[model samples]
Target: MAQAGTFVFLDYYGRLAIERGFVKPEAEDEDENGEALPSTSGAAKPKVPTISHSAALIEDLTAHKTAALRVELANNPDVALVAVVHAMLLSVAYPYNSEQSALQLTLTPERLEPSMKNAESCKGLSAFNDLADNYGHHLPGNPAELFDWLLEQPQDIVLSLLAFGAAHSVNAVEKKFTDRKKGIEQANQLGRALKVNMPDWFETTGDSYFKHVNRMTIELSLAEARGSEAELSVRAAAKKSEAVTIADRLVAGTGWIPSPLRIAPSEAEQELGAESIAEDEQFPQAAE
Candidate 1:
């Protein structure tokens, strides 16, 4: 099933592949006057070196899906759910290097554990266990050399991760409904953490599920912004009301609320009227 899906994807890629090098316009047998041409001296469309299918896939895998091929892949569950997941992480665990030492590292048991207690210690661990568990096959030597090895990663593993991401986004939205203020704060914090913890992972595998995740993320940001705007509006309204209240009281001839340092007019006019009041008392010295 996996091999069949891969070839189908490859066929799609081949059709979309661009031709390499400058495309010369059809050589004219004759000039505009219908006479034999002497020399070929017209500017040609610069041949863009054909981008490889793998490179195109990588770009589509890393960027927004603008092509028709991407739209088809998104709709097809078999290809969308499995092949993309596998390809996104294809070179992750086992890097393609010719060194024999790197090849031998593939035999480590920890490397083989998907749910390892210590992921760092498991580098190059042979995926023999995955094969035994029907999740993946152990590549005998350098696994990176063979495309077949990548095609064999367990579909279950790929699908499970995709489902988990989708569910997490849904859960985040639900949390905001129940406790909006804290929820927005928490979501923003989590988004920032994801940016920090998995910067490279996001860059490579982000496109695999970006469309599924981007909408909810945008909502979270907009919700937070709305909350902030509401708070600011309330404060501005409150200040406006206070100013109106003071103006009304003044017009009515009831004394307005005094400044923080001043007593009401009764206390202020008497002492303030005294011409002998010390300058130090009128304007208190600053505290040391």
Candidate 2:
């Protein structure tokens, strides 16, 4: 497949939108019939100056250096143009940093290499490229245009965001599934390598960890929306946890303490039908 040029569609769409006033007003010469006229009797019509979506996005983002936007950029450095546009909108709507930094990190070249085997990665990149191609033509000069363009987008925008996981997982699955020699062991090996080598790339927080699980459920629910069954698994693995969180009590000793020895149940536990023994399993304690 021929590689698409960066910002080509953005520039083309932006120029079209600007010329047609779909974005913002641009000076145009026209005749009484409302047909665009030549700038000079002998000269042809002047081609409109154009800007890329990235350029336009940066321009719009630069206008709002609000505190909220600053904080969001700090959290998710990968969220380029869209984050800035969202920040500006919030500044107008609530007039404060009502929303925290919710941007996702960018996938750098090094990061990309590890996830290259994941099929979902290709799917995501394809989706982004396709989306950029289609919507690239709908550059909105202002927030209104942006909003309109967003509404016109397919409902799978959310899926696109979640698709990143599946994309990253694709490369791993391919190595295991594609090669004749590779088998289930390859998947296990790749899974372990991914977990250890790229901990930061996967879910590393309590809330984010939960979100990954939820995203897996959502992926299953939207199975038909995804491209294939492989994509479903890729999405699931993308949200998988890399770190093993050992309990404090477990870590305090040899990490081999029995579960029954962990804690003594309170009256609340008995009321809730929760199994409760005692901190020392050998001796039973009365509920206080």
Candidate 3:
């Protein structure tokens, strides 16, 4: 089953993709004679490049329908997405590169070009050619920016690409990033804005914790969760499964859920003040 997320940014991103793909595109540029504009000095014009396939992807992704997203990709090929996928698969194809340690996160252009080219050939997507032509050596910026861009994508496939690309291809070439906390905060803020039903909104169980992360990491989490001394001792002595049981009650919800749920503001709240609407308009700055 497809997982729900905090931010629902597909609608805006989908529209952006369609607009870039067709509406008033640069390809429509014309001269005064109503003929296609000539490049300066009679030079051939470079192909215009922009993001694409967002709207189609958005339809499936917004609903968290991963299966539907694959069907969309099958019916309508997108080059950018293909490049993103094939490139990511290579990262895990080998043993972890722990020996050649560096903080860099993006794949080298030389290694990536052939893979993208192969996908472009297979998919028959000229957009891949555009992507290679323009951004083969480069990708979008930091994790926060990448996460922000991911939310803007319309499909689960596209979103997953950005996520994968950041960790695999894009990050390989990029330099070591320092502000991990900011990226996390950005994610939390986006989740809150999008109104996602966060998994953690449920009582955290040993199963959820042990499955995803190393058990020792719970020590830090316990500290942040403000567990009791007894709970801390439990975390130290008990298995991760047992530790999480105590940890659950110590933590507050992450704010993504509508906790302390209640009705929205009443008409009296909407009125806000004793002054009438017209009176407020007359004294424009008074409310401020």
Model 1 lDDT, residue 55, Cα: 79
- The runs of at least 3 residues in candidate 3 whose Cα sits more than 4 Å from the true structure, single-residue gaps closed, are 1-77, 93-178, 193-195, 199-288
How does model 2 fare in lDDT?
0.39
lDDT of each: 0.38, 0.39, 0.44
Candidate with more favorable, higher lDDT: 2 or 3: 3
Number of clashing residue pairs, candidate 3: 8
Model 2: worst 10 consecutive residues (lDDT sum): 242-251
The alpha-carbon lDDT assigned to residue 202 of candidate 2 equals 31
Q: How much is the lDDT of residue 66 in candidate 2?
A: 56
- Estimated TM-score for each candidate: 0.21, 0.17, 0.22
List residue ranges in candidate 1 displaced over 4 A: 1-66, 96-154, 157-288
RMSD of 2: 23.7
List the candidate 2 regions with Cα displacement exceeding 4 Å. Answer: 1-66, 70-105, 109-148, 151-156, 161-288
* Model 1 per-residue lDDT at 163: 41
